[model samples]
Target: MRENTRIDWHARVEQALARVFASLDEPLAWQTLAGELHASPWHFHRCFRQLTGETVKQCLRRLRLERAAFQAAHGEARITDIALEAGFETLEAFLKAFRRAHGISPGGVRKLGAWAGTIAAPSNLHYAPGEPRKHFFIADKGDAHMDVKITTLSPLKLVCYRNFGEYWNLPGTWQKLFELMASQGVAMPAPTGMTVFHDHFDEVPMPDKRSDAAVYVPQDIELVEGLFRYETPGGLYAVKPHFGSCEEIGTTWDKWREEWLPTSGWQLDKTRPSLEWYQGHFDFAPPELHVTLLCDAVCRA
Candidate 1:
């Protein structure tokens, strides 16, 4: 892993705390846990703040509160009992934390009458791909047909590379493509399909493609040295043209999943990972340019 100024002791501490919180049935006191990590309470507290942006107690408290809400929303137990189980001494404290974490009160949760059915509701995984549907953003509906046209595309053959290791500090994979072309004697294009592929649920977002990114390349090009390859199997994509800083492209994803897909006569096709097509200048890439994001949708055959 490339060492950066950002690495600190508290990160390790936070990770340990997360593990402890998840397995809280067999609990350990602060000092005992501190001894296990071989750090003084004062030092651990300081490092926790520096790394997690929250104090140790607050971190544990927050995790407990989240657990309490989860349990209350799922377990067949009283709110007060669930609150105590999560380490909240008072129901009031649990209520406050619950509201903050879920944007709803404990009482509201009970009144909803179906904890198993609600509470951040589990996403449905379908056996087959979703159907294709056209979505458009009109500049002006008042304008004539000349102003707009819609086109459909068949499945695409997407060549890709998986990033691994400490990918954050490294330069964009675009450079890797340049080198790949040099070695293989193939021409490359200004990228039309560039995306960071997150295959699992990890909350903290990082620049390292090792954590994400299953980038696509031209079909004819051979895999270059130091780069691994894959294909985003051809499928229907609920393509959207998102123009923004690359870091902010996630907003488009949120909008798509929450606002659009839910009612758009289409369910997510999980076969191919979503693709991000760059839309702005390639001159000064990384941390500076705007881009487009496409949420790939595998269509029902």
Candidate 2:
């Protein structure tokens, strides 16, 4: 195969994997996926393991368990139904796997309404042809200077563009959103734009990070393709202004989670997502950027 074609295979496999996640109700067969990729089953399996660092069986099992765990915690579905949906033929078999992975029963998780162990959904793995792979962001050692304040915010309704993948790749999503907004005659110098994070990227794998590039808009704006309204929950939040490049903001979040929250006598409100408020037009290429990181907090201690 040509080098470019070989590289393209990685993307093709990633899309196929995403399809598997999206259609968990459908039958999952290696032969079916291999035929779709136009490769023999043995070659497809080898390529998948090389690109994703996990075997096909391992990935499917993890994805199923993670989905089941999420449904148990958030949905009003029966445990047996969830088990069957996750491809388990029997509730006993599902329970055994769930307990082994999470150290708690599905019923126990539902009762607590929270995950008891590290159960994360599989992320889409992308491999560049020749570029060196970059590791996930990590904070520099030491206390980052942060202007932390406690503030209350009213609910905000926004028109948002959603993206799933690495946090660092979010600028592309924003770029697409800007083009859509410009086409609609929306001005560039609007108030600060916001990005709401549904998952903590540092804790979650890169493939699983979910974020929204959003701007506050009136309730009556006409919705277009790829743009939907998101209503943010209003409550008390610990806000901190971060000044630097988008690449460095992860360090700021690490500081807040590790250095500040522990001493502030406040606990994180797990139900709501954290927000990133961008001041002015965010130039993704520039080394300096200004954003405010918002964390939902309550004085529970």
Candidate 3:
């Protein structure tokens, strides 16, 4: 049974990869993925990363670059056109990535005959890829989702209003907490307010949307509300920054859980809570969200 399960899992990983390729333009949502393998999104993310040695998002980025390189080498399209076609919002960003990936400009590739005839495929990028990540997070299957990171954090106390009664009322719950915290001199950093879901969907029937978040503060400070004191333990966490709205943050986790973690030579230890630091002054508008997925080292029993 174990061997059979392994074989099935490998086949599913391939299918997931195929899906990623097929749905490049319009990314599929996590909820929609359940029918693909009869596994929850949480478990599927774990299994896919464990088997394929890369996460879905990491694979997507590579796919985009691969397409860009191919277009540069063969397509009649201009560099800007090729970059836009590959989902890069601007030519500058595309060129920056292209140079890093292939060690030459897209225009330079045409200047050299050597790049011709050779498939413009990406060389395997290991778990700790040479690529730059502004903001990102990785939480794999185990108790804690962190795999690797570099950070300097101080101990903190969080005063949170619990949402134990229902699951979906997360946005409102967060708003209420923020209001209370603001009244108590706890203001959130502007742009995107972060949400970290600790429990998987399967484990908890109605998952809270306002799951948990770190108080955005520049320096160590303490302020408490009545019965809402939550402590944020201080330590180092593997931090991956993403510059996008809150809605797009899941892709960061997908990349880490599926790609970075398995290959990272690190394990998940969820004893410590992860963090999210929003940039700018506190506001409701969707802003860039910086997420930190936390996991601690453990000695096996």
Candidate 4:
């Protein structure tokens, strides 16, 4: 069962969150925390972000603000004291940031009562005087929604442009890649567009997530600036053909992991990358419907 792995992840994150809550005023001890969790810094960062849907920095800041709000609304502490405790060095800086975060000055939180300390967070985590959450973030929402096919793949020679940032902004990158292709006079034997995710979707924040927009090209294809030619080693993959808006593709992949992988008699090959093949018109408009084959590398379970 996947229970052991999931339990271990939850336990590790619970420990880290507790440590973070203990020192809201200080920067999180990333290396030490990673050590305690028995994970590399990169892996821990990704795991935390994936579990909370917010980076550690973002989580710490929001949690501290929640505490400040609680103090303002219910406690008799002075506003300056609350602000300082919340990690702001000065009252003015605190007020500006506080207003920006909660849509009002610290003073306004006093009128909110029960709602005062709550803020919109992806994980629904808040600052409360209680034990940490066992289930930090929503997982396993994916069902048998995508039609997944298990198959073997051949090697691929690709010329790709890597981009980093919000995946939602990938259409813009696709457009830029096309322009680069035209400017370099790249010919059209490029039948399909490929995207290779160097990091897991949850491994890094959207800004740091590395995605390569690639097209199949010759092994000896001449490379230009911002474009590199490389061979993608292929193997067993679980693929799903997603039709419609590119924005909805994430759900497909999520279900592929949550619903399919556990039951499929295969496991993800972490050494390889998550890959995708788009076999349709390159409208460069993410909102426009398109067909995509989402491929995840796998090995025998």
Using TM-score as the measure, the top candidate is: 4
165-247 per-residue lDDT for model 3 (tens digits): 33324445676767766775655542334444444233445533235643544444445543244566666555655444332
TM for every model, in the order presented, reads 0.38, 0.48, 0.39, 0.49
Order of all candidates by lDDT, from best down to worst?
4, 2, 3, 1
* Model 4 Cα lDDT, one tens digit per residue, 1-301: 1678767777788888878877787767677789987899998887777666667788888889878887898888999998888888899999998876665566765754444345655455667765544345543223444468888888888888877865544555666777777777776436777888877656666668788888875435456688877678888888887654453466457756887789778888878888878876645533223578889888889
For model 1, residues 211-276, the per-residue Cα lDDT tens digits are 233344455666655655554454456676544334234534564566555555666555445555
Expressed as tens digits, the lDDT of each residue in 1-301 for candidate 2 is 4668757766767666766655566777766788888889988877666556466667677767766877787789999999998889999999999876554678876865633223321232222223433321222222334468889878888889999975645667887888888777786535757888887645677678789998886536566799988888978888877754453456457656788778777887767778888766654433233445555444465
Residue 235 lDDT in candidate 2: 89
lDDT (CA) per prediction: 0.48, 0.67, 0.52, 0.72
64: Cα error in model 3, Å: 19
- Winning model by lDDT: 4
Pairs in clash, predicted candidate 2? none
